[model samples]
Target: MNHNLLLDSIAKHIHLDEEETALFLSFIQPKKVRKKQYLLLEGEVNRFGMFVTSGCLRSYNLDENGFQYIQQFAPEGWWMGDMYSLITQEPGHLYIDALFDSELLLISKTNLERLYKEVPKFNYYFRILAEKSLVSYQTRAMENLRLTAKERYEKFCLRYPTLVDCLSQKQVAAYIGVTPEFLSKMLHSEPELKP
Candidate 1:
């Protein structure tokens, strides 16, 4: 299961001795999703935080015009869920769905808070994680709105080389705020994208 990978990731910021580690590990359950399945829907409250072990998932918002804007994609070793829904127990603002069949290590919100209480360092870890996520997404948002197609494609490839190969052109284009055909042209013209 390579539990060490998960353990190491968390331990870097938060440490758990033998007893606390056991309790924390006990609540994390294995979850799986078939392709095209929903981890969460826009109107449902999210109760769990998912850590991807394999495959791909995306969060998107459907607009009044029925357009889907891909807000984020979490592949292996990434955390996912609707933060607003999880924290507030309100309806999720985005839909979280499986882009590929997936396996996840999950922790319920109840257990998550319990873990935080049992291990105060975990609270600090979460704070760090939240801040980093916000900053990274803010940078991505700025780039999408301000950069040229070639520049954005270059940045995307540089930043997410792993995910770039897994996603469809249409999906990547949506994330980058461009049409699929436009993304294709950029890919061909840009040496970084061309093999």
Candidate 2:
């Protein structure tokens, strides 16, 4: 695995000197997850915040009826975790799983705090991540309310072409808030839906 991918991603946001970078890397624990493996399950406390170095991971929830609703997809360079659980040290409702065999760099909450205190600049990087996450969730909520199924699919295709190709049609339909059957019809109806 390319451990430098995590370092490069951090460097993009903050200036880390050699010693600081080494210290940061020391705090990260590299993990490999198999496809379909659960990194976190509903009701489990999230011990670490994860950075995807390769392959895909997804955060989702299951309804009472056992239907899946995808909250987010984390491809390479993306981060995943339940912030509420990590912050409060409580069990989380979200389920996180590897959609494909994946490599990750994980930092525990304690280590993250130490990194903030030692490096300081990581605070800014995490802040930007949180802000972007907020914007993404807000946009998704708005799109669900305002956009048609086809429009949502179009926007999704534009935003996450990689995911559209990597994920199954049913998974894409769940993310876009449509039944797989309906999404199939919509896709067949439009040539542009082939993302």
Candidate 3:
């Protein structure tokens, strides 16, 4: 495994000693999620909080009508998991799956807590990460309520430029809460809007 990118990733938030870093890195297992694979299923505990190294993932909810509503997308450098399920050991309301073949780093709850004990300030690091998650989802909801469909699609595309290359059109439409056909038209016809 290339330890540089992973170390650089963690160092951006908090520097770890060689020992602590080694222990932390030992806990992060690299895995590949095949295309159309489910990392998490609804009604199951989230065993690992995943970090994307490449490719993309989506978290969605299936309704009684069997319609899937996409909640969030995770691309490279993003974190994806059912935070509630991982924290509480309760069944998750969401299903997390890969949009394409993915290179992921998996960290379990046990090791994360172990890091908190070992590294002292690791809890603070995770807290900040969680806060970002909260704010991002909150902002996304706000944007959905406040912006037009075209506006929301534009914002999503701008925010994740490599997304189209990494994810399918179906997944992109799911992220923006639009049909694939609509996303296609919007992509071609709509003028760009500044964020």
Q: State which candidate has the highest TM-score.
A: 2
TM-score winner between 1 and 2, please give it.
2
Instruction: Indicate whether candidate 1 or candidate 2 has the larger lDDT.
Output: 2
- Compared to the true structure, candidate 3 yields what TM-score? 0.87
TM-score, candidate number 1: 0.91
**Candidate 3's residue-wise lDDT over 95-145, tens digit each?**
999878889888898887787787887777778888987898899989989
lDDT of 2: 0.90
In model 2, which regions exceed 4 Å deviation? none
Candidates in descending TM-score order: 2, 1, 3
How many clashing residue pairs are found in candidate 1? 0
TM-score list, all predictions:
0.91, 0.95, 0.87
Clashing pairs in 2: none
How many residue pairs in model 2 have overlapping backbones? 0
Candidate 1 lDDT, 1-195, residue by residue in tens: 546657877888876789888888898998889999998888999999988888889999888977778888999878998989999988888999999999888899999988888887888888998999999989988887899977877787788898888888888887777778888887777656754
lDDT at residue 155 of model 3 (Cα atoms): 79
**List of clashing residue pairs for candidate 3:** none
Off by over 4 Å in 1: 188-193
Residues 72-131 of candidate 2 have per-residue lDDT tens digits of: 899999899988899999999999999999999999999999999988888899899899
